[model samples]
Target: MRAGVCVILAMGALATMPWAAADCNPPMRPPANQRKFASQAVDSIIASYQPKFKDAQLGQIFANALPNTLDTTVFEHTTSGELAPDTFIITGDITAMWLRDSANQVAPYMRFVSQDSGLFSLISGLVRRQARQVLVDPYANAHQLEGSPPSPHTDDSTSTPAFAGTRVGAMGPTIFERKFEIDTLANFLHLSASFFAAAGKDQPTFGAPVNAAGQTWADAAELVIDTLRTQQASSEEEGGNPPYLFQRTTSQPTDSLQFGRGAPAARTGMIKTGFRPSDDAHTLPFNIPGNAYVVVALREAAAVLSALGRADTAASALALADEVNAGILAFGVVNHPGANGTVLAYEVDGYGNSYFMDDANLPSLLGIPVYGWTNTTDPLYMRTRALLLSKANPYYFSGSVGQGTGGPHDGLDRIWPMSMVARASTALSDQEVLSVLEQLKGSTACTGLMHESINKNSAGSYTRPWFAWANSFFGGLILDLAETRPHLIFA
Candidate 1:
C-alpha cells in the first residue's frame, strides 16, 4: 500500500501485539471450548457470553467478529520519547500505521470506552498521535511507528521500470509512505470528531486542554480544515495552490505516479488527491467518492468545531463540504450509455475526463452510503451502486463461490469483505440483510476469520486473513443486526 501517487489501501490481520499484552476489555465470559481462533484479546472477548445474546444460536459469531478486528491487529502501545501514548495501530500486514485503518480499527471499541479505562487512554493517545501525524504531513497516508525499522520503501528512486528522469529525495524521519490520497486526511478529521464525540459522551471533560495537552479537539479540527483549504486546487473557482512533490524509486509501475504527479486539475471545488483509496494513481484527480467523503467527514468536523467554540471554523468546513458536494453532483455525475438514467463517476479530472467505475475501497460508490454521504436509496447512489456491484464496474467480480468488487492492491477477482459488509449498511430488507450475513458466515474461509478479500471462485481461496478492519466492521454489522433484528441471528 506504500505509494508515491497511487494507493491501494492495505489488508491483512496479524498479531502485532500478543493477546497476553492486550489490557483492553478482556472477555467477560470463559471459553465454551479450548479451540481459539484468534489471539487472547479476542479470545477473552469471544469466550465471554453476552446474556442478552444467550438465546441466539450464532451469538458467539457476532461476539468474535468485532473483537477479531481489534485483537488480531493493532499494536496497543507506541511512544515517541516520554509521551508513551498507547496507540500505534498498524494495518494487518504492514508495519506502518494507516490513518484510514487505525481510525476504523479503534472505532468499534467506542461503545466500551466509558467503562474501559485502558481503551479510553488507548484511543485518546491515538487521537493525539494521529493529529500530530496530520500536522507533520497530511499528504502522507501512512507513518512510521516509534521503534520500528525503516520501511524497505524508504528510498526515493525512479519508480517506473523506464526509470525516466528519476529524482530521489531524503526520507522524512518518521514517514513510512507518503502517498497523497484525499481520504487519508478525511479519515483523520473524521476520527478526530468521532473520538471527541465518544469522549464527550463518556464525560464532558475528556478532551479539555488538561487532558489533551492544550490541544483541544477543536484545534485539531481547525488544522484539518485549514490544510484542506490550502490543498484546494480542485475548484475551478480557486487558483493554483502550494507546490507539493514526492518521488520514490522502484521497479513496479504502480509503486509511484508515472509522471511524479497527477494531471492538472480544473479546480471544481473538489479536493485534489494524488491517489485513490485503493492507493492507485487516479487518471483524474477529483475522486468522486473522495469528494463525497470529505462532505460527510466535514459534517462531523463542523459539529466538533462548533462544540469546541470554533464556530467560524465549523462554518467554513461546512461551506467547503457543501461546495464539494455540489461539485460531486455537478461534475462528478456523468452520463454513461447503456447504464441507468445517471450514475456517479468514480473520479472526475474537472477537465471533462471521468472514470466510470468504482474501486472496492471506502469512499467508493458502494461505500458512499456507508460513509453517510448519501442515502442508499438516493437514485444516483442506487444507480452507481448497481453498476459497481455488477460486471459493469471493471473491478466487480463473481464466480462459483462468492463475488464482490476487487482492487489491484489486493488481487483479481478477490472481493473485499469491506465491500460485502457495506452492502448490508444500505437500505436492505431484513431478509436481504440475512442473505448477506449468511454469505459472510461462509466467507470467513478456513481460519474462521475474515480475510481482506475472499476468493470469488473458491471459498477456500483468499488473501490477508488477519484484516482487523474487515472483522471489526463485519462484527459491527452483526451487532447492528442483533439490535434491529435479533431473530436473524437465530435463523
Candidate 2:
C-alpha cells in the first residue's frame, strides 16, 4: 500500500534489533479463502510496513507487534486443536479466553475484516461464544472452552446467583470466574455490536448473535435486563436480596462481605458490581464508572435490538439504560476538592460517601468518553479527566518514563498501559496525544511488547510481561494516530 510513498527509516535499537518471533512458524491455514487471505494479512501486515516506516521506531513498534502479538503462537483452534477458522483465542500467559480480553485483543484487527472473511467469522465466533457464556451465567466475566475444566479464581468470591426470570437453555463449561462486574456485560454487548457491524458489511447474510439455544440477540438483551434488575434488588426492593456470598479462608485480606452477600447497595436504579474491573472487591457495592458504562451498554443493546424489530424489548432496554444514565447524573457525580468541581466518583453507596479516584480499567472516569458514555469535552468529564492524570488522584503515578492512572490490581505507584491508552484516546490536544505516544514508545523495557503496567519513573521496570491486551491496545493507539493525527506522527 505504501508503493507510492517515500518511506523513512527508524533510528534506534528498535530498527536494528530483529523481531525474535517475527513470522508465523507453519503459516496460517484456513479452508475458506477469506480466512487464508486474512491469515496472510495478519502474519505480514507489520513487515508490509517495514519499507514505509523504515526510520520510524514508533511505526516499527506498531508494525512489529500488531499481528505477532496475537498470532497462532498465542492462540490456536481449541476445539479442533489446530490453526484455522473460528478458533477460540486465548489471552497471553493463560489458556482461557476472557470475555473482556478477547474482545479488546481482536478489536484493532477488525479494520482488516472487510478484506478477509476468516477474521470476520473468527470475531463472529468470539461474540457468539460470549453471548452463550452470558446465558450460562451473566455474572461470569471469564470462561473455559467447551469440555474444558473451570479455571480457578483462587476461588475468591461467589456471585449473586442469576435470576432465572428469562433464563435460556443448557450448554458449555460453567464459567472461569463468577465475580460480576458491569463491565463484563458491557464488554460482551459492545463486542456483539462491533462484530455484527463489521461482518455484515461484506456478508449481507450475516445475522445478529444468538446463544446455543435458538435465542436471538434480543433474548440476550432481555437476559441483561432481567439480571440487572435482579442484581439491584434488595430486602426492601421487589426481588429481595440476591443470595450471593463469598468467604475465603485465605490470608489475602479479602472483602468477605456479609457472609458473601454484599452490603445492600440501596436499590439505586444503578447496577452494583460485585467486584471492580480490577477484580478487586468493591469498597462499596455501587461502582460509579460501571454504572455509567451500563447506560452505554444498554443503549447499544437498545439500538441493536430495535434494528432487529424487537420494539418492545428495545424500549425496555432503553428505559433501563435511561434509568442508569439518570442514576449516574444524580448519585454518581459529586464535588471533589482534587478536581475543584463536580466529577464522577469511582464508587458510591446511595448514601453520601464515595471514592473520588479512578481505576486504570474501563468504566474508569478517564475512559468515560472513550467508551461513548460521555463526551470528552463535557466540563465534568474534562475536570475529572484532569484530576485522574494528576497527582491528586491517589493511584495516578509519575515516574521517570510516564504518568497515568493505575489501580489496586497493580499496587501503588504503578501505571497501566491501559490507562495511558484511555488517556490518549480522550486527549484534548495533539501535543497531549503526542506526549503519551512518546511516553509509551520506550516504555516496554526492551521486551518489544507492552506490559500491564510500567514504572512511571523508569521505562524498563514493569509487570505482566505477557499481557496481550496492552500490546494490542498500543497497536490500536498507533492506528488511531495514523488515521486521526498523522501530522502528530511527524512531530
Candidate 3:
C-alpha cells in the first residue's frame, strides 16, 4: 500500500522492462548481520538448494522466504536462568503472536529438530509458551507478547452470551484478539504433537508446569478438549445463544457477527465457530474444514497425552475425534449438483443448508488431504477439489497474473499465495507442483517474497508485504519440494 511497495509491484508486472527486471529480482533479503535469528540446519538446506533451482527468480524468492521468519520475526529466545527457556515469535508487521501463525511459522523446522539442539530449544520453547497462553484463555486466537500493549479488539463484549448455563470465561490483557476460532486450539495441539514426534523423546518433559498455579501441558490439552466439547452445542440447544459471543463496532460486515451471535446452527455434534481461520465471521455455523482439522488435532492431542502417560485423557480425545468425524460424514458431505457427485461442503447448518465455496485459508476444504482429514486420492475429495478449483467455487479466481483461492477477507479478484502453497503441497504429481511454482514465481511482483494476497490481474498490487507466516510457509514448501521432488526444483 505504500508508494515504494506499489512501485515495486508495478515493476514486477513488466517482465521485459529492463528497470523492472532489475528492480523486482535484485537480492531482497537483509544482510546476514541484520538477521534477527540464525539456524545452521535451515541455512544448510537453503545453501544446498539455491544452486539446484532451475528458475533463478524462484530460487531467489525461496532463499528470501525460507529464512524470512528467522531473519525478521524471532522476537525472544531466552535459553536459561528463567522459569523455563522459551521463545516468542511475532507475526510480520504485527507484534502479537497468533496461536496458528507462530506454530506454522516454525513447523517446517520440525524435521531438523534432532539435528540441532538450539533449534530444538527454540521450538520447544514455543510449545511451552503456547501451553501457557492456552491456559490463559483457550478461546482467544492470538496473544500479546509479554508486556506488550493491549489488543485493538479488547473492547469487544467477550463474556458468555445471554443463555449459556456456565461462563465461557473473560478475556485477559494478554489476549490480542478474542476471535473464537476452532483451528486456534487445533493448531496448538498440532504444534505439540509435531514437536513430540520430531523430538522422539519418551520422557514427559513438555508436561512440566508452565504456570504458578501448577498447570501442566496436559492440563492445557484438557482445557482445549473441554472448550471444543462445550462449543459443540447448537445455538437453539443453548436457548438461542451459544456460549461464546463477540461483538465489535466495525463497519466491515465480516468484522462483527450479527446481534453478537453468529448465524444459527442446530446441534450437529460438530463444534460451531464464531470465526474462520481467516478471522472472518462464518456465513454458516459449522465450518467443515475447521471440523476436519479438529478431528485430526484431537487425534494428535490423544497421541501427545498417551506419550505423556495420560491414558484417560488420551481416550477422551480419541472419543471426541470420532464423534466429530461422524458428524462431518453425516452432515458435511452432500450430493452436489454442481460437482455431479457426493462432495464435501465448505460450511453447513444442521437444517440442510451447505455453503459450497472454499476459502484460501489453511483449514480450507481444498486442504483436506494436506490436513490429513482424508487421503489425497479419496474419491469424494478429488471430486470436491475439482469443483473448488474451477469456476464452481466463487472464491476461485483466474486472471492475467495468476490464479488461486482468495476469500472475502481480502476482497474480490485477489489470489492468496498460501492457497497456492496448499495446492502445491497437496499436488499429486510433479507437473501440478511445477504449475503452482510458476504462478508463485510470477506473483511476487519482484519482491522475492510472498504476500498475503495479490491482485489476479496485476501481480504488483498486493497486501501485507511483511507477513511472516506466508513467507516462512512458502519457504517450507520449497524445502519439502527440494527433498521429495528435487526434479522439479532442479529443472
Q: Where in model 1 is the C-alpha error above 4 Å?
A: 2-61, 78-85, 157-170, 201-217, 234-242
Global Cα lDDT for candidate 1: 0.67
Per-residue error (Å), model 2, residue 85: 7.3
Candidate with the greatest lDDT versus the true structure: 3
Tell me the TM-score of model 1.
0.82
Model 2 Cα lDDT, one tens digit per residue, 1-491: 00011112232323333333443112222233333123555656655544464336566667545764455223543322222224466666667777777778888887877777666656666666666677777777777766676555546546443567432222225566666777888887877777656666333222443544565445666787888877666435634324444554544443344556555567677888778877667887888888787778788777777777778988988898888788778888898777677888888878777887778866688988877887988998888888877877889988656788888776787788888888899998988887887677656655556677765665445676667777787777777766787677634
The lDDT values for all models are: 0.67, 0.67, 0.84
In the range 382-478, model 1's lDDT, one tens digit per residue, is 8877777777788888764456777767657777777778887774688777666656655654345666776665555566655667767777776
lDDT of candidate 3 over 96-171, digit per residue (tens): 8899999989988899989988788888888989999999988888888767777777777777643336554467
TM-score of 3: 0.94
- Candidate 2 local lDDT, residue 228: 81
Off by over 4 Å in 2: 1-55, 72-87, 154-173, 201-212, 234-243, 254-258
Candidate 2, run of 10 with poorest lDDT: 1-10
Task: Rate residue 67 of model 3 by lDDT.
Answer: 80
Using Cα atoms with residue i matched to residue i, what is each candidate's TM-score against the true structure?
A: 0.82, 0.83, 0.94
Candidate 3's C-alpha runs over 4 A off are 1-23, 161-169, 203-205
